[model samples]
Target: MSGTVLVTSRSFGSGGLDLERRISDAGFHVVRAGAAHELDELGPVLGDAVGWIAGTGPVTERHLSLAPHLRVVARYGVGYDKVDVDAAARRGIVVTNTPGANTSAVAEHTVALLLAALRGIPAADRRVRRGDWSAWYTREVSALTVGVVGLGRIGRSVIDRLAGFGPRVLGADPWVPADDPLFDRLERSDADAFATECDVVTLHAPGGQTVVDERWLAASDRPVLLVNTARADLIDEAAVAAALRRGRVLAYAADTLATENHGEGASPLLADDLADRVIVTPHLAAQTREGVDGMGGMATENLLAVLSGEPPVNPVPVP
Candidate 1:
């Protein structure tokens, strides 16, 4: 092998794609590391690494400084928010992500979470396990006005799935053009309308912006079921927990949490009183077998391209 390619993502070859063998065949040694991306743990490996396929952990400027031989940082998922693209660019390192690789998986999971929350599936299952066979009253999807925040690939895919359920779908996104054909299928609305008008709102917006906060929840006239398969920061956990307690938010289902790697105890949504109305998954919305393979393949391809002196397939633009 000419150089080492660091693989920090736990789910890189989880789909049985043999991505490590593919990297090895390209004349690069593959080195496994923890997904946490600890400086101490990665210092030794970073010195000789030519490429890195990182996970959700933050890749900072300090990390780029340590990897003198690194040519590329291949993010093993759609979102590259965790990776410091600007820092990589300053150090002449290419940053790439697997865009659209987990679209279908996340879209499907979003709908699953919506249904799970709307129907109280998780709580119902728990009741059954405790020998309670009573029917759980839940509203039908067809009767509710569903809202989708963010009209990107995954958001649009979610709207496509919601069409079959016969609900009047409302989409919100400041970025999507008003003339876009997406409005022909679903009604267009702003952020404020989502809180007041929507009976069930599913979040698909990018991270860094908090869409659902105390103010947003306060705008709601009635209880609404909220589902999030996107970033955890999209909703304020404290606000959501308070809403759930006051019956403003009927249910809160998310595939992620603000305190994931550190501890779940730090999250207010996991409170004992809110257990029946909250459904939290371990950020596995995009962990489907097909999604895993797609992300791994794209990440590997991008890594190989940059290592061979070619532009990456899905390079994240440096700001």
Candidate 2:
């Protein structure tokens, strides 16, 4: 309770919740560090830190080894793949994430990217700035067959918003029960089935494996607009770029790049020719004010709970 509370998440307390003030009021000194969570930079503070509000950085065994007093690691976002949970668990440290906190924000961003790619919004804006005002035809959402890859909280929210568009929504989630209410309204299909039926395919699957590759694109019977607001590893960037070149993928819109955290030099999706068909954002899908507040509040609460000898609301199970 008297030691420092280390905060490595860049956007941890930037929300309306004033999470830093709350932590400070609990008699713990709050310390800030880089989102990268470098060993040298965090070594000094880790020794005195009781709780760590981590970002999308790796919390390896090396990091846990440095912090003898560390009791909990509250991930500031829903995804915790970057964190080394086994190391924390071995050290008797609780790991928690703000699940469903940014669901609405990310879902809205997914739909926005879909619309942007569909209507060529960025390209049109660029043309207008250069004084070219030629009109181009675009397909309406109501006319396209949209396929969603995951049916989790954010995926369900995306479907709910897409309902207003009146598109033929096809859902794909092997994890979800077949009797789930979502399948009642939409046809349940797999990602492979989407290639032949869907005009637009948005990815919401969990990361760790490549879902979209050259083989998947080559199986397509028509051009498909691909949107990914989930993870960078979800799609094979090189394959996607190739598909775009061949017109198999009409457009590729995503909120992340494989080399985004470092540099995008290796990604073929950023090539000059593919710029017309590729749209990439800097992983800001869950950076809305409301989303930030929800994530910050939940993370802060989790950290405080563990430090106060109470169980966290959202503890991640050790696998």
Candidate 3:
């Protein structure tokens, strides 16, 4: 009860202050570790903390080695790519991630991006303001074949939303169980087949893997509409821009980028020539009130469980 719980994530309490109060009311001292991206900066705090609610930082073995009393690391969100799971497991540290918490929000955003990219919503709005609306024709969502890369929770949610649009949704993910109910409504496709056959390609795979690279885009018969709401690492931006310029890719809509903190004119996709073909959001797909609250609650529960010497509600499975 006297041990300190270090909350390294700046966003852990951002959903609401009630969760933070709950941690304080539990007779445990809560401290902020200031993003904690660097192990050395957090070394002073990690040396004594028994629990660490981690953010999107690199939790390397060196960091784990520094945390002698660290029993658990409750990741703030779904992806734990930054956290070294094998290294933590080797040291008997529990790691948990909040799955399905941001599924609905991200799925909704994916559909929004689809509509925006296909309908030219943003461009048409600008034209209307400038007093010039000659003609505009966009692709219809109902007619296109959408190829979803991963069939995880968020991927399945995207398909669920796409169902009402009457689009032919093809899912490709070896991780999905054969008996999953989604198979009844969704058709299976291999990675290459999905890239070649589908009119639109949307990525929902995990991080640390590039599913939408030059090779993946090269197989497509036509300029494909590519959407990515999953992770930045899923796509190669330079390759996407090159394809977009050469008319090999129709458009790209994404809620993620190679890096979050980009200065003025930093990304290649920001060029004026590709402006009409690329639409990017500032990673706000899963920042909805409902999504944030769900993530916070789940992360808090995970921390409590590990602190009490019990298993987390959603522990990330080790391979």
Output the number of the TM-score-best candidate. 1
Give the per-residue lDDT of model 1 (tens digit) for 150-256. Answer: 99999999999988999999999999999999999889998788888999999988898999999999999999999999888999999999999999999999998
Q: Tell me which residue pairs clash in candidate 2.
A: none
Per-candidate TM equals 0.97, 0.96, 0.91
Q: Rate residue 69 of model 1 by lDDT.
A: 91
Sliding window of 10 residues with minimal summed lDDT for model 2: 257-266
- C-alpha lDDT (0 to 100) for residue 70 of candidate 3: 89
Candidate 2 residue runs with Cα over 4 Å from true position: 264-266
lDDT of all predictions: 0.91, 0.91, 0.84
By lDDT rank, best first, the candidates go 1, 2, 3
Over 199-293, each residue of candidate 3 has an lDDT whose tens digit, in order, gives 89888888888887889878878878989998888888999999999988888999867766322346777778888778999877888888888
Between candidates 2 and 3, which one is better according to TM-score?
2
